[model samples]
Target: MKQYCQSILIFFLGLNLAFAQNKTENVFIITTDGFRWQEMFGGVDTTILKDDKFVRNRDRIKNAFVGKTAEESRKKLMPFMWDTVAKEGQLYGNRWAGNKVNVMNPYWFSYPGYNEILSGYADDSINSNDKMYNKNITVLEFLNKQPKLKGKVAAYSTWDVFPYIINDKRSGIPVNSGKDLVQGNLTEKEQMLNEILKNYPSLASDRHDFITYYLAKEYIQKNKPKVFFLSFDETDEFAHEAKYDEYLFAANTADKFIGDLWSYCQSTTEYKGKTTFLILTDHGRGDKIKSQWTSHGQKVSDCYQIWMAAIGPDTPALGEVKTEGQLFQNQIAKTAAKLLGYEFDNGKPVGREINSVKN
Candidate 1:
């Protein structure tokens, strides 16, 4: 009887350890601004690739982005998503399969979309991409207010308006966005990055995503924040310029960047096995008319269609969800908070948590 009781005690302790290890402690919210579900799901649009108006260097685009079929093309475009995330996690908004994800906001542009995403509310007053401080509190702010997460939430974005979008002035979250970036107590790498920032050519007040990536990486290494948001903007910029070649290149490189981030997390002791990655776009571009792919706003049709993916120790490996379903961008905030074992509530009707994204 004594031996049997000892065995049961050890078994229960092992079960408790497993349960604790299964909980996700860190979350990464990554957004590729304005990347559409079409290119993400169907790969390269051959129609756009063939049009001389868009593809200036057919040889380069074909050599790099094109595949004989749409599936092959998309696999080449975002290998990390199709090959890794789809296999190990879940992907939504593949309209081809009727698994749809969209923005709850009426205005299908950057600012409104991001607001809906981080705040879980779509305030109509946030109608423009103007640098107006957000009136709503975001999941980041709510998380920072938590006793355990204070000073452990950070945001980095390629767009200048992020400070206003995240409302860093009020939230007190350290948001590093274009022009207003890291300062004081600089590491050697940070000093070089700031020097490069000074000489780099500006692109519509958007810092190059590469620079933003390095700065975020440095911060992640140093701070090990409980919550992190890294937003890349070049895909949207190149698309708006009608540069398909550059847009495809931007998407491809961003995939590599995401893969690098996940790998770093897995290798790091503080982050390994505890971090969850929730990847998606801020908004979508027009879909059917081909030319409309370059524009994303309330005026553009099908611009509300967006995609989302989640991978982590807690999320089951369901791969690309083929079952017919609907998800909204507003759900992201709650979903992110949920992963960290918190129910985000601030006297607001936040979007319901996406239970399917996790265990």
Candidate 2:
């Protein structure tokens, strides 16, 4: 343990000394809860669409998203990801193409996956989905501690547990999640939103992803935060409910949300060419058996596999990378921090920065 700590300290020292600062002064992280790499790369599953157990409106989804080739179909399914990011950014973890990204944690679930993504450490103790305050210091918290970035980091999620997952109380980063309303002076839009959300429909424990997106967008517009995070849950919620059509729609809608947010960032002065968008899934779903597509955990096969996409002034335009290599979820925290020229170190050994993303 002593040697390990020494190694980590030295690693970050060298990392900081050799760091190449990029143009990204800010970063926006967006995630689709439990979204799969398969659908992300191959488009909607036609076989599953035909099953009564899966889709609600087969013909409608077909007409809207399906196409003859994977390239064509994926373009229809998530137009912004295909048309824009594909041309201007990098997409990782298309397993069929040999590039892969996997969860470093043992448990293939939300909290553990997110912990790895945010903390850059996969604690085996974080094995549950309960509303427990995280002990680890996330990159957000690390940035929040910075003199220049204090009070400029914020996160929002559809899941009520986010306040606990992020440990907002301890980190001092505001996490507006679930049924929580905008505090302090509320905009007229915030007032209206709060009223509707008080009676808003939800799937089990999660509020609507669209609501979460808009709420976060309002905050982003209001504050122009240096580090902003949003996690949408409908894709995972619909999959858990066995509503395949809703899941696909959620994925497609998430694409539109990304496009909208990026468009806004480009139009705004604070974000324009100075911001980077980092996108990924909290976890991955099953794949070996068709019926297991809705399930994830330690028991689920291929649930460790995940995907990520990036767009920014510094990232090279390498869409859907076909190179044969592997990356882990733990690398993302440093990747996000490094985009803005920070070495994310919380005293634990983090996965090294993804060098490819720096260019």
Candidate 3:
């Protein structure tokens, strides 16, 4: 144990030295819960609302929502997401043509998926159906230990488990979610949002985690943390409710939020060109036949497939190509560590850096 402590100390010393010698760049990792490629690529049917169990709202299904194309709707729903940033950035569903998950397995749910992404290895030891507050050292914790990144990294999630996923007590970065506690002077828009939150009881204490985007956006302008992890939970929440229309709306909202964040970053001097934003999901839903919002957990080809997109200084322009090689959720930890120039206990190298990111 003493030897282990000494090794960690030495590793951190090296990490700090590296950061001191390099330019300070910001990395924002944003995740939308249970987002699927189909929704982002192929527009959803406005009419048919299905649950995970494949149960359909027949009446609504009969009406058939002939909605705008995904691309068109993406632009309309989120002008900034599709317009400004996307032009210079990339979207995963299309960035890597034909790129998708390997296969679905028993751990095709939120907890397992999150574990796989942050811990650099999936834990079969995690078999419980409970919210995870422990078990692994997250990428956030790993990065936080580096003296070079002092006060520059933070996490905000709409989900209650963020405190656990990030281990806030141990990590020390501010995490705001669930309750509304906007800390600074409210802009007119922010004031209106506060009114909306105050007027609407449902949005306040639902135990649903889905407001991290707005919170992070607000915090970014105020605190300007160099590394920010923003997790949105509405898609997953609506999926569980089996409300297809609601889920679609939730996705639209997510796109808008992302658009807002990107736009704000561009206008902010600290962020603009120096920032790199990455978006992805913890996991995806099962095949359509399984249900719109019904089931996931067992191995289903659909459940494993997820998408990722990156935009900013080190990214390439809008285009399509296959990921060079094998990639896994574990790579996220290593990739973030690399970008921040931090060291980790998991010394395994990252699978492949997203193409075009400058060293």
Best by lDDT: 1
Q: Write the per-residue lDDT of candidate 1 for residues 34-131, one digit (tens) a residue.
A: 99898999988888888888888989878887888987898999999989999989999999999999898888999999988899997788999998
TM-score of each: 0.93, 0.94, 0.76
lDDT (Cα, tens digit) per residue for candidate 3, span 60-162: 4324432456566445544555566567776554323565543222577777677666665566666554756755777777776777677878877776666
How do all the candidates rank in terms of TM-score, highest first?
2, 1, 3
TM-score of 3: 0.76
For candidate 1, the TM-score is 0.93
lDDT for each residue of candidate 2 in 201-291, tens digit (9 for 90 to 100)? 6854467887888888989999989998899888998988888898999999999999999999999999999988989997899887888
Please list the residue runs of candidate 3 whose C-alpha ends up more than 4 Å from where it truly belongs after superposition: 1-24, 45-81, 84-86, 94-97, 102-106, 180-199, 203-211, 290-293, 299-301, 322-326, 347-359
Mark the 10 consecutive residues where model 2 has the least summed lDDT. 14-23
Q: What is the C-alpha local distance difference test score of each model?
A: 0.90, 0.89, 0.63
2 against 3, candidate with superior lDDT: 2
Clashing pairs in 3: 47-65, 51-293, 51-294, 52-293, 52-294, 53-294, 54-291, 158-209, 159-209
Look at candidate 3 and tell me the lDDT of residue 234: 79
Positional deviation of 95 in candidate 2, in angstroms? 0.6
